[model samples]
Target: MKKFNYQELVDSEQALQKRSIFWDPAIYEEELKQIFNRCWLFLGHESQLPQPGDFIRTYMGEDDVIVVRGKDKVIRAFLNACTHRGNKVCQAEGGNTRSFTCSYHGWSFNTEGELAGVPLEKEIYDNLPRERFGLVPVARLDSYKGLLFGCFSESAPSLIDYLGDIAWYIDVVTDSAQGGLEVVGAPYKTEIPGNWKLPVENAIGDGYHVAWAHAGAMSVVGAIGNGRSDNVLGINANNTGVDQSGAIEIVMNTHTVLTTLDGQSGYALYDHPEPVLAHLERNRPNVIEKLGELRGRQLYGSETHIGVFPNVQIIQGLNFIRIIHPKGPGKFEVWTYAMCERGMPDATKEIIHDHVRQTFGPAGLLEGDDGDFVEAITHSAAGYATRQMQGFLGMGMGRKAPWDGPGEASPGLVNEACQRGFYNQWRRTMEADNAYGVIGQTAPVTPVTAVLKEFRHG
Candidate 1:
């Protein structure tokens, strides 16, 4: 096993990332231990297991975990491995079950992960104590605005502290809803032939690719091509006054009426369409007020997007949360959840779901475009010369500054703020000795933010 000098590889501000970080098995192993084990990773949402006996199986890196709602109504998570002879405890993805039975042996565990039964305990090992062999539970678990996260390291900071300033951004979207956001259903799971970090980095705020990489999709949607839509090059452009290249506006107006939509707020509004409005109208004014008219309109009519760090990417306008799980240095398993508000009308939900399926799922058009680029980039790094060459992230390097506005804004769709912010944070996390150190560092800008600020006050 190759040991890496974590500090040397990641501490400097301008140092380019070593290509081996993406393709080396030994480095990946260290990431699993140093990063995944210590940092709070997003588990499935609370809605996935709302009732007792309901459970969903998910991954924390490569380790399998069962997220369950206990009889006490509290949520809990446990390793899927059976304590008796080490067999997998659950085979299916998610469902309501009284107990999980290990197929190899008849050992059973309840919703709370307590060892409930052992088939023929008297016959096996002269009656081994059931209390001594319950399923292993994760060290820490917490939720922020309905999104649950877990960590194998007990010393990790609370989920709120870990989220830090990013929580403010998340709240702009999640808390915008009256009842808060919920996952639509099970994730649309699939695999991609690229490193896991590629997709995560892309969605962390890579707006530069939307016009070029997803040009075909944009053209089909009746919007002008990103570059052709407007004759602006690099970061600065018109529209919102943020750097043009870094900001790609999706559905800013409803029938020519301009309305800016925040990611989570848009989700709540869209999830509950006309039918939900009627339902609310029948109730009371307070209920209707909770679902504000403009917010509701934006929800049903606007877009949703997210900048969740490390590995989750959500596009509310696109209606999916893409989770990238690293299978190996060169392989990734991409899981997408087609989400909407819980009480949304069936017709509206279906429309959003179908739209998401067509745009970003396993066989979707836009997904195909991005997958090609990710794989090609990973492959190109194989050449010694190519690996030595530094990739460009200076599209709007020193451009952004603090904005005194309702939300962070930027200009064009080609800025590098998002990608830069992601890498900056990634470098910090990888270099830190623990999660606390990672969260304590200064806030970094996504490429869009950097460029917009630069132009505003450069």
Candidate 2:
């Protein structure tokens, strides 16, 4: 009747136990404290809260939160629930408001989270403890390049240290243009019946599925590969060289990046106009100067995929960002955003947004295909016997060799190195007794000396 120990459930260096990790309610509860509470989870972007009084309602773990820009032009998040009866104070998803009023009662709180209004100040209770009932604020909040993040634990690491080498990779997309990037419009919000980790793992470094799981979708978009052999499965048929030596997969702590380095050939799937394409070319010097020559060549006009630790995924080539909000052990809310270059032409922005919506948005066929598989895994893993077995992550374990670059680089684009790295970090955090100890550690250093021969950047 007892299951394996938590250590046995997640042998992230090799494999992970399929069932208990995915279906156990106890482990999920532990995740809330050890993982979500301690980590810097993504909140809304600064672009969304550009003006004072602007606000957007989002979540940190299962807790409801409202990110608001106060009159002082400072962004802060408070618990969305009113302190009086625990009723929701702000019902609107987002708006510019001076204060939030509870629908259940007349208790009102100002943008700064101060108790400002009460139904009966001196009539019912004679003297009300207004100061004691103010809405609670999140323990810690920080941002990186306009991407806001909040942590429930005060002792959590600074957001920069938390990002580590992955920040450099993110700068490729976030800092590509002179003015940086901005979300085109509201996010495409949808709920899916799947574990939160399912999408995280897939986004990080699951290029293996694109050729197979999305083969039909790719065919519709005329991206199924030019003159490549297409069997009934139509997989591994892309001759675009995106999966060849041009593709590099790097696993950095919990974050992962898969980038194509073979020049402009990587944009074969995109149909942007010449002017739009030239925008990236104009920014080539910025990338080269910010990142070294190696990363510069790899990221410029290249198809890039990124997974930011616990739950943020970005496809730089496609100009979209995905935030996965865990609902429970079996469900999650997927927030997809169309990210456009800040100073780009209006037509370019429209092209980016419309293309993103057609390919990976809520109504996208590619999303539908991914949902089917994600739900299937969660649905079938609930079996009593299946929980006893484990899932394989040994794809490119020993195939990782040192590169003349940053992060842990492996050979194949479809490798499981990133997946293994993800689970390994998850296991360490989930098993730690103290959140401070986990966040206090320095950024993980990949021992390149042990992994490959000495090489120099030309």
Candidate 3:
């Protein structure tokens, strides 16, 4: 937990992170304390629990929690553990329930998390105080456009502030349409023997991996990864026969956006692009009028791969929201949910869900295409000498963000700008004493220091 360990673990000037960060148990424990506990970790979308008594079990860094809709119509979360003997109060992933009863002792808690009933109460105790035994609540719970996030630290800033200017980009998908986004079907869950940060970095717009790693899926999916936004990352667009002219790649702090500018829609890989394209075209004018021409017209159907710092990610067009849950230093769970505009036809929703499953689910086509290295890098670090080496994120260094978004925006998806931003925030979080030291201290984040926060000149 020493400051020097963090400094060495992530040396930005060298544009590298120690291989050990993906393997060490001790460093993982520190991350739970410094990063997971304080940040506003996404829990579940409100659409998942609509009725009173509806609940779903999810996790916040390894801490299991129950997110329920109260009879009073408010959403809240509490530790899944019963206050009695620490046994889980509920086991079902989700369902409508009058109350959660501990399977072992029969202690029960109501939706608001009050200790509503205790079996054999009169005989078991001499006036035991029921209120003292309620399910322990998460420190802070809040929502942003129906997405739920919970924080264990009381001093953390409001959810909107934590999102920063990233909200504007998020609005392209969430707020642009008449009705905001919602999870369409039950989330697809799978466990990967990979470090949590690996996936986080990948989704932080690792557009570089899309071409080589997912080559098999490329041809079938219209080669969307063939550098369509701005000419194959550096390779000429003409070489691939995919015209990249007029398409714009918008880089935001910790995110990468690709707009198939001038009426071109983004989800090229879907089975029937006509349905998706029609939907986008139908809504184009309305969104443009609401969110402005630049954000609405360009991004409404654009391919937006956004990683909301730490671990939540959203793919706007193919449309799935991902929550990367940390199981341990070398293992994590991928919870994938399809996101679609609430106003869309049920058939369109079905299309988005099917495509999300085929592309990003556990046994997905592209999953195999890109997962080998993710598994390899983590397990490789078990070797002592191997773990000592540092990994670099130096691609696209020294590039200034000509456009205003947030954080430093490097030019293309091939750039490791988001990865560097990921580690810089990780470094600042590990080095800070509390939540206030990192997020919300500033608005829209004053761009990183003159030389990238971690990429120091001296």
Candidate 4:
């Protein structure tokens, strides 16, 4: 693949050349090399593989992988391809298994990915060195707060370093619950007829579209997405009836966070029961003392929308985490997981599940709107005239200002600052010769310091 200068495609902080990058197969091919192949992609959470031999089928880019808990109680991942004939070795999504045997040739591999049994062994051909034919493991694997992430490139930075300041913000949910978080049920998986990047941009706190695209669904969930909020982004208090102003829009590295400062608790949107509210309320002082006044207040109320660069998007108020996988230039799949406090009652979990399903799953009322919108964008780009034009993203340009806050603080939820940040990082990664080179280099336009690095918000 030719090394396309992503900087030229991105133009500047305020503008982006949309058509060539969004719909071109050539661009996607290069992205597979520079971005997907080099980054630390999230695989499965530790909670998903609780016991020895438990495993789950997941993807890193388009490559199928089997993540398993070994007999030694260590987690590992291997390419799900047989050493012979390139046949898929595992088909099931997840279950406990002592070994995975290729259905085609009957070659078996143990949980540690060592070649165990071969159909012919010493009979058909001189017993080949079995040790040399074990399942091919990924280059590197690591975890942060129980979230498993694997990197195909050995040169990639450490998982925590790659996460950067975004880790500090994500811990609000990952570290908040008493026993940490877990995937409650099977993921809601489905294909979206749109470029994978579109969804990533949306989840990076795309407050601009929520009020318009999901206006109807917002009414059903709560008044949160209605225009009653103090800002155009409709990020007011959960009880939308009350009038309040002030919203926090923060862009850190490739991550984006949107929070409403309206005094009402974010729990109101979920209709959270009093006990749920009290639990967080009881622990509020600790988080407050840890994160200081502003961030602590924001963390206390579940009123933030966050997206960790490349793929993972989390909505604290909605209690949902989604991982976007690129299937092709114009198609992608989203794996949705419902999250709740570990010790919550069954009834409470059920309620949380229902809410998450109704709001963000494949058939989710609000999610349906976003799918249609992004798909429309993809379809429109097919026309020759549309493909020749450049797209505008100058929302709140020249408005970003350094604040004493945690990340790159900016005002106005409707701004495209996060989109710029996303493309900027994309350019950096694509420009680098290797993944480790991506460290210490963000959008060149600004310098990032974790001012609150020592603050343990949760």
- After TM-score superposition, the amount by which residue 33's alpha carbon in candidate 2 deviates from its true location, in angstroms, is 1.5
Clashing pairs in 4: none
- Model 3 C-alpha RMSD vs. true structure (Å) is 6.3
- Order the candidates by lDDT, highest first: 3, 2, 4, 1
lDDT (10s digit) by residue, model 3, range 1-458: 56447778888786799999899998899888878887888898888888999999999999999999999989999999989999999999999998999999899999999999989999979999998999999878998888899987666667777777777877887786557778854788888888999988887657667666776666455334443343333323233433434443444433344444444445765656667778888988888888888777656787766667678887777688888999998899989888888888888878877788888888777776655788889999999999998888888788654554444455655667778778877887777655666662533333456225223311
lDDT of 2 by residue, 165-208 (tens): 88887787777756877975579998999888888888877777
Runs in model 4 with CA error above 4 Å?
224-245, 261-265, 271-275, 289-294, 401-403, 440-458
**Backbone atom clashes (below 3 Å) for every candidate:** 34, 0, 0, 0
Estimate, for each residue in 1-458, the C-alpha lDDT of model 1 and write its tens digit.
22676444443356356565666678778777766776788897887888898889889888899999989888889999999788999999999998999999889998888999887777756767778889999878998868889888665567777766556445534654446567866888877777777887676556567556766665553123333333222322233233342233221100001112321222222323344335334432433255454444333323434555567765555556777888877888889987766655667567667767776777776677888888877777777777655555666554543333233344334555566556666665666654565665443433676446434421
Tell me the lDDT of model 1 at 402. Answer: 35
> How many clashing residue pairs are found in candidate 3?
0
Query: Model 2 clash pairs?
Result: none
For candidate 4, which ten residues in a row score worst on lDDT? 449-458
> lDDT, candidate 1, residue 61?
86
Each prediction's TM-score versus the true structure: 0.79, 0.89, 0.89, 0.88
Per-residue lDDT tens digits for candidate 4, residues 76-136, read 9999999877788899999999999999989999999999999867888785888889999
Candidate 1, position 91, lDDT: 95
Candidate 1 weakest lDDT stretch, 10 residues: 250-259
Candidate closer to the true structure by TM-score (higher is better), 3 or 4 = 3
